[model samples]
Target: MYTYVLFVHLVAAVMGLGAAFGFPIVAKSAKTVSQAKFVLNLLHKLEVLPKAGSILLLISGIVMGLLETWLFKEVWFIGSIVIYLAVQFIVAGMLPKNMKKQLAALEGVQGEELPEAYLVLGRQSAKLEGISHLAAFVLILLMVFKPF
Candidate 1:
């Protein structure tokens, strides 16, 4: 049962983080206003996978922690959970707002070139995304090494 839950957790992480890692790549591919709009729409739809994956990750992680109660007391586990929640806030809360602002900025633009506002928002979003990715990397390290 624990192994099965662990398997689900791993799968959720891959499905969620994989989709997330691909987002900037997809967004970067757009060369025109129309393409940018289309890409943003596509990204909005693609968000479902990560959202579902996050829920699964949370559930499976909690179940595993419950099953192995000692994990709840471990510093690495606690840190991982904290980092996960922080990443979730950035991913679920911050990123969407930034994307919406980007969309709004795009709405007023008249050319193939992305507007300065949109570009600024994109850079901000990219920074947030980078931070989330880094946090995820730290979570992986904590999970793998259980240092402390």
Candidate 2:
């Protein structure tokens, strides 16, 4: 039960991160509006992952740590989930809002070149990417170490 739950948790983390990865690819391509199709596809892929993988991962992980064993006594496992959730919250809040801003700008421009504001948003997105990637690494450590 422990190992199985761990496996599900890890897999969910992967899915969530992978979904977020679409933003960099999409945002980078946003500079070239003509090539936004690939980015759009990536965004579509990302949109589907969390709804599916997140639930499974959360359920299995909670079962293992909260109920199956006293794993919560371990700081690493607990910390990892906390960090993961925080990262998810930032991603959910930051990225989509940025995208929506860009989308609104697009509506104004009617699909013309991206504005200066959009570029600034893209730059900020790079920062978000770095933070989320680091969070993912910490989660990996928590899973492996399960440290108290």
Candidate 3:
């Protein structure tokens, strides 16, 4: 039923967005080169949760829209969908690329201090992550308030 679908959607959002919101904090905890490398590798592995959650989110959201039918015509619903897709693009396409660059930049570094190249890439990744977080916040607002 609708309630069950809504439940699944909410769970997916939590699983996906919760991991996303935690990423910056996790990444920021690295103080040494080894820590940074370990964190990045761990983050890469942790990406699977959000990826799976995102897929479930999209599927459940579409099913709910189909069930309701009227939601398709709502401004808030449309806006949420748009924002969701944008976040997806950033998460799926941009973030991984940036992470890979960060990892590569860490290669051949010979000190405890983080290199400038890795720092630069980390900053870029953080900015992208910030944008995605903002988009996600807006998406949540739209969903919760339905402020059309």
Candidate 4:
């Protein structure tokens, strides 16, 4: 059972990272309102897939941690879960909000008019995404090493 779960969790992580890499290209190419909406929808769907994966990973992680006695005094184990949750909210909630607001701002403007607002939001998104990647990597390393 744990083996099956670990497999699923790893697969989910790969899929999630793949989606993250692809998002910026799609987002930048969004020109019209419909395009923006479409991209946003796709982004949400993609984001949800990873989120589901993370949940499975977390549930299985906790179970495995206890059953295997790996969680004892493991800061990385705890930190990974906490950081992943934070990133989940940031990506799914804040990132989407930023995208929508930028798109809305674009609606009334012309000629590649992405406002300074988007720059701020984009920077924040990048930071969050970077942190998520790092957390995921740390989690993987800790899982593999199990060095307590």
Candidate 5:
């Protein structure tokens, strides 16, 4: 049972965190306002991967801790939970708001080049995305190594 839960947790991490890493690249690839809007819309749709994966990973992780009993007391586990919650908070809270602002900034524009406001917001969002990815990597390390 623990093995199965662990497998699910790992798979969820890959599905969610893996998809998240692509967001910055995708956001950067847009050459025009329409293209940017389309790409951002696609990103919004793709968010399901991370959202569902994170939720599942959280549930499965808790189940594993309950089953194993010692995991709850481990530093690695506790640290991973803290980082995971932080990443989720950033992903769920920060990214969407940033994206919405970017979109709103673009809403009135009509051109191939994005407005300065949109570009500035895009850079900020990209930075946050990079930070989120870093947090995900740290969580992965903690999970794999279980280092105290």
Candidate 6:
């Protein structure tokens, strides 16, 4: 049972975290406003994969911890949970709002050239997304090493 739950957790992490790492690459490759909008729209549509993975991770993690009964006592486990929740808050709260800002900045703009406002918002969103990815990497390290 533990192994099964752990497997599910690992798969979820790979699915969600892997998708996250791709965002910057896609966002950075946009050469025009239409391209940027298409990328963002595609990202929005594909968000469900990560979101589903996140939900599975939470459920399986809690079950494993409950079965082992070390959720509160283990430092590494506690840290992972905190980091996971923080990442969730950023993903659910910050990222969407940032996306909206980017979209709003691009609104009514047309041409092969991009506007400064859109570029600025894109940079900001990229930074936030980068941080989230970094945090996710940290969480993965913690889970794998259990250094605490």
lDDT of 5 by residue, 11-57 (tens): 99889888888888899998899998999899999999999998999
- Candidate 2 regions exceeding 4 Å error are 37-45, 110-112
5 against 6, candidate with superior TM-score: 5
- Candidate 2 lDDT over 1-148, as tens digits, reads 6777777877886786676655576557555544543464467566678656666776887888766567777777678678867987766678667666655544545564666766676677678887977877777676777666
| Residue 113 error, candidate 3, Å | 1.4
Could you give candidate 3's per-residue lDDT for residues 57-106 as a string of tens digits? 99999999999999999999988888898788889999999999888888
Each prediction's TM-score versus the true structure: 0.97, 0.80, 0.97, 0.72, 0.96, 0.94
Which one is best on TM-score?
3
C-alpha lDDT of candidate 1 relative to the true structure? 0.92
lDDT of 6 by residue, 1-148 (tens): 9899999998998888788778778878888888988888888887887898899999999999988996668899999889999888888788878777777777888666878887887888788898898888898888889998
lDDT of 1 by residue, 1-148 (tens): 9999999999999999999999999988887889989999999999998999999999999999999999999999988888898788899999999999989989878778888888888889899999998988898899999999
* Model 6: pairs clashing at backbone N, Cα or C within 3 Å: none
Write down the lDDT of every candidate, Cα atoms only: 0.92, 0.68, 0.92, 0.68, 0.89, 0.85
lDDT of 1 at 21: 92
Q: Can you give the lDDT of residue 16 in candidate 3?
A: 90
For candidate 2, list the clashing residue pairs, or say none: none
Worst 10 residues of 3 by lDDT: 80-89
Model 3, residue pairs in steric clash: none
Higher-scoring candidate on lDDT, 2 or 5: 5
